[model samples]
Structure formats: structure tokens, C-alpha cells
Target: MDDVRLSLREWLILKDIESALRRGRRIGGLLRTPRRSIWLPTAVGLLVAASGFLMVAGIRTSDPAVIWAFAAVWPFALLQAFRLLCRWTTPHGISVKASR
Candidate 1:
């Protein structure tokens, strides 16, 4: 029974270490990818642009309250565009580039 308990503890510790190592490797890989970081910003920009266009085209709704809501959300599109532009201009080796 004692031996069994010892082995179980050892197994658990090994599993923990393995999981930690895998997480570390994943983080390292993320750091290595130059385009990973910019995906969110690009998506946000597209969403904003789409929403703004919808508002302008009167496709969203004619209600003044709804138009105001769309207008309020318009800045996110500009923010996303700025983020994408920055990511594109940043050097490849930098952390910012890795995320984009």
C-alpha cells in the first residue's frame, strides 16, 4: 500500500511537470509567431467598419436611438485600424510583431 501511494504521488508530480513544460512551449511558440498578435485588432477593425457602413447605409435601423448606438461604436473601428497599422509597421523581431 505504501509503495502504491508513493508511485501515485510520483505520477502526479510528473504530470504536473509535463503540463508546465507544454504550457511553456506554447508560450514560446506564440512569441515566435509574428502574425498572431494582430489578428484581433484586424478583426475589430473589420467589425467597426462594417457597423459604420451599416449605420451610414441605413441598413441597421432608422430609429434615432439605434443610429446613436451605432455611431457610438464607430470609434472601435478606427482603434482597430490603428492597431493593425502599428502592427504592420513594427519590426519582425519585436514582441509586438510576434503577437501580430
Candidate 2:
């Protein structure tokens, strides 16, 4: 995370927020507005579904391509499964910490 750099717009936004708060204006509520994420959910959904299909196909056949696909996909699928399980058992709106 420390290696990551903010883009120009993000840096400007942070600066603006800091300046606003310094002037004693109530500007924090502007952050609660949801920004549009047009493709993120759809992309993740597709990736997970493809991973599941690969895992199942690899287990059912001996094709080299299927084996390669499974190798690439299984770890992501397993991690996603664990995340989903945690979300299901944990209380709503509480974020779970993943171990390093």
C-alpha cells in the first residue's frame, strides 16, 4: 500500500478536503456519496465463474489445457470461497481481516 501513488485527481481531492476542513467547513459528508463502478462487479463475477468451471473440468478430464486452467484458477477460486464463507458467517457490514 505504501508503494502505491495517488493519481492527480485523487491528490487534488485530498488536498481540497484538507483545506476545507482546515477552514472549519462541514465537508466530510461529501465522501458518503457512492461513485459508479460500472464493470468491477461484472468482471469479478465472470472471473469467479470461469475459475469454478475450470476447476470442475480439470477434475473430470485429463486434458493438458484443462490442467493448466485449473492450476491458474484454483487458488483464486479457493480464496474467493473463503471470503464468501467469512462474509456469510460474519455479521452484516463488518469487514473481515484477511491474514497476511
The candidate that achieves the highest TM-score relative to the unseen native structure: 1
Model 2, 62: alpha-carbon shift in Å? 1.9
Give candidate 1 regions above 4 Å deviation.
1-38, 57-62, 96-100
Candidate 2 local distance difference test against the native: 0.67
RMSD of every prediction = 11.7, 13.3
lDDT of model 2, residue 77: 64
Candidate 1 to truth, TM: 0.47
Give all TM-scores, in the order shown. 0.47, 0.40
Model 1 agreement with the true structure over 3-93: per-residue lDDT tens digits: 5554888989988876676579556554453555656775986777778776876654577776776777777777777777777787775
Write the residue-wise lDDT of candidate 2 on 1-100 in tens digits: 8899999999999998777775663444333343434454455577788988887888888788998987887677667666656555766534444544
State in Å the error of residue 100, model 2: 23
